[model samples]
Target: MPIRTEIVSQDRIVYQGDADMVVLPGIDGVMGILPNHSPVLTALQYGIITVRLKGEEYYFTVAGGFVEVQPDQVTVLADAAENVAEIDVARAEAAKTRAEEMLKEGIPSDQDRYLMIQAALRRSTLRIDAVRRYQQGRRSRG
Candidate 1:
């Protein structure tokens, strides 16, 4: 069975289609959804959403949001999202490095800097995952 998915952002819909399964980055952790799963709504985390469609894998990086599963239909109201194909690996790598430096310097003792660093790390990880997936797709295609 297939589940309908809709990935949304404030500006537009990132994706919508039928998928065999969806792997989400939940606030608590990652979770997989399939057809006939129990209904529930939960908050999202910065991470990857993997979709299995027609035997091919697709990946999207979502920066937090909400997820609603109603029967076989799963909808994700993502705060921000980008497909793997859209990621800029160099930028993501730089962000990751900066976040690591901030984490090490401990300048967040007074500011939200620490929290922002954590957020940057999450975003960087999401981008890295997306880039890896895209590269894997390229390799598989070739």
Candidate 2:
């Protein structure tokens, strides 16, 4: 049995479909969810979310959120989420560069600000990496 999954961001629903499996970037580590898995409600980290459906895989870059898992469904309420297909490579690159520069300069005076910047850097990096990996996969397959 496939698990019903929905990923929602602040602006819109990022994805909604039935997936055979889902791998989420959890706070502790990656967590894989399958059909009939035990119930869980956990905080997610900035990283990639992989969904497998009908033998095909979909990738998304998710920036921190909470995931709730039931016996039959999984829901991701993300701070921000973008599909690999929708990602603009140039924009992601620019954001990554900006984040890197900010990190280099250091926001050490404020712990909260420093951590927030670090998270942004991580999100940007994950997006760039995801897009490149998707493009590479397409090229290899085609």
Candidate 3:
């Protein structure tokens, strides 16, 4: 039996489907969920969420969130999420560059603002890496 997986951002559902396996980037580490997985709720980190259906894999970049897993379903409520295929490589690159510059210039005095900037850097870096992996996978298949 496939597990129903839904990923949602503040505005809309990023993805909703049935998958044989789902891997999430938990705050502590990566967690893998399969059908009949035990129920648990955990905070997510800025990283990747991978869904496998049949023999194919789908990748999504998530910038922090929370994930809940039950016997029959898995739900991810993300601060922001984007499918690798939908990501604009150039835009992500630009964001990464800007983030690096901000970090290098100096840390902000406000702890919260500094943390937010760090999170942005992490998210942009993850997006770029995800896009690279997606492109590599496509090239290998093609």
Candidate 2, residues 3-114, lDDT tens digits: the string is 9999898999888988899999999899999999999999998888888888788888899899999989999999998887788878878888887888899667998988
User: Which candidate number would show the highest TM-score if scored against the true structure?
Assistant: 3
lDDT of 1 at 108: 74
Assess candidate 1 and give its lDDT.
0.83
lDDT of 3 by residue, 1-142 (tens): 9999999988888889898999999999999999999999999988888888888888888988899999999999999998887788889888888888988989988999888888777878888898887865431110
lDDT of 1 by residue, 1-142 (tens): 7998888877887778888898999988899999888998999988788888788887788999999998879999988887777678999999999899878876678567677788789889878877875776631110
**Candidate 2 runs further than 4 Å off:** 105-113, 137-142
What does the lDDT read for residue 118 in candidate 3?
A: 82
TM-score of 1: 0.78
> Candidate 2: global Cα-lDDT?
0.86
Instruction: Itemize residue pairs with steric clashes in candidate 3.
Output: none
The candidate with the higher lDDT, 1 or 2, is: 2
Clashing residue pairs, backbone N/CA/C < 3 A, model 1 = none
Clashes of each: 0, 0, 0
Question: lDDT of each structure?
Answer: 0.83, 0.86, 0.86
